[model samples]
Target: MSSKKGGKSKFLSEDLNELLNESQFLKDSVSNKKITKRQKNDVTEEESLAKLIGQYQANSKKKKLDVNVEACKESRQKILDVMNNQLETRKEKSNNLLKNLSEVMVQLEVDCNAMKDNEKKLEHLTGAVVKCMQQATTAHRQKLKVLKDIHASFKKQCEEMEMDHKTETDKLAEELEDDIKKLQEKLISETKRSGWENLRRTIFHAMQNDF
Candidate 1:
């Protein structure tokens, strides 16, 4: 609304300036001289009367024109005064709008700073999460290595136990074969001694072989 009023006021001011110039031109035209010479001899009364009437009409027109010019000048000044007032009001309104816009700009700056801070905080949080993930991954790797070592140790113990069992069984079998050969020689000698001795020797040989 203020802009509209300002536009109208500016146009009115321009028109008044133009009208003032026109008024000045009309005043100049009214005051300009006309070149004329009166015939002193044989000038008829009718010609004089006609000339006077013409002068009167001319004067009347000039008076009317002067009055119109004065009225136009006054009207133009009134319009100018009104335009000046409107311009002042518009200027004040424009100043107020500029102040409001400046305040809004300040608020926007603050909001922008807040957004930057939030972005910084988000970046920090992202970095922390990444660090935590890295720690977890490292810990998992260490734990996996420990578990692998434990499994390898248990497998080695099982292999050693199996080798020990095989060796012990072979040694026991050899010892049993030696004891059976000794018992067979003792029974053959007893049979030549006596019948009773032979029976005793046979029982002794059987017990030795069992051992």
Candidate 2:
């Protein structure tokens, strides 16, 4: 989430920088326009003064007019005053623009610093994420190893149990065979006793008499 916010802030910063550049461009254009207007005003005033001088020369040649001389002087003084005032106004305006431009430059520097800081922060976050991922991978690997060991142990236990069962079954079978052998021996001995021999002879004599 922090990473996403950082990305958005970066985008907004870039946009703001672009807007600042456009604003500077517009300000420069406006400053140029003002200078051009000032120049045009000066040229128009000069042309008017030149025409007035020509008219005064023509009138002086045609007749001696005192009132026209005073008017011409006053007109020249007024033109000078207007020119000086306009020059001062232009100079003041240029100074103000320069001051503003300087301030804009400072702001741009600050924004650049801010962008650098944000980039550093992002790099830090990326490194942290990488570290976390590595740790998780390591943990998972360890868990898998543990599980594998457990499985191997279980398999070994199962084999041991089966071997024990086979051993017990073999022991029981041996004991049963021994018991059957002992009983068979006793039966054979009883069948071959002295009483059984006497009975066999009696049965044979009886059979001869009947014949």
Candidate 3:
């Protein structure tokens, strides 16, 4: 009975050692699983951070493109406005030049008409002067002809008067010479008669004394 009790106690000690070894193995497996799960969670967090960074970069690039497009549109509108203003100014200047040209053309036409009228007047005046000169020359020729006729008539009258004067002088000279010859003959006859009468008277006186 003493040997059998000692063998049973030894058998019980071996069984208790086996249970302790099994419990240690289970604790080691639980620790290894916990470490693997913690590693997986860390990898998932790094992937989520990478996705957020990519989204932020894409949004920034889009905003910059939008700003550049808006600036380009504003610049194009300003250029168009300036070009339109320049075109309007040039159009106004062209209209003013056309108006001035029209005014100049009107004045030139008026001046040309005036010159034509003056030329016609000058031609008329020249014709009138020529006509007057011709009339004056005709009148002067007629006057000269009349003067020459008067001078010839006066010369003929003077010649006739000189001939009548010469004839009257010759008639007076002949009548005076005949009257002087008759007076001389009458004086001679009277003297002879007176001498004969004186002698007869003397003889009569002598005879009366003798008786």
Index of the highest-lDDT prediction: 2
Per-residue lDDT tens digits of candidate 3, residues 81-112? Answer: 66557656655665575566556555655655
RMSD of each: 70.1, 68.5, 89.6
> Candidate 1's C-alpha lDDT?
0.51
Best by TM-score: 3
- Per-prediction TM-score: 0.32, 0.32, 0.37
> Which 10 consecutive positions of candidate 1 have the poorest summed lDDT?
33-42
Off by over 4 Å in 1: 1-43, 118-211
lDDT of every predicted structure (CA atoms): 0.51, 0.54, 0.50
Candidate 3: regions farther than 4 A off: 1-35, 126-211
- For candidate 3, what's the RMSD? 89.6
**Model 1: residue 112 alpha-carbon error in angstroms:** 4.0
Report the lDDT tens digits of candidate 2 across residue range 106-153: 565565556555655555577776566556555655655565565556
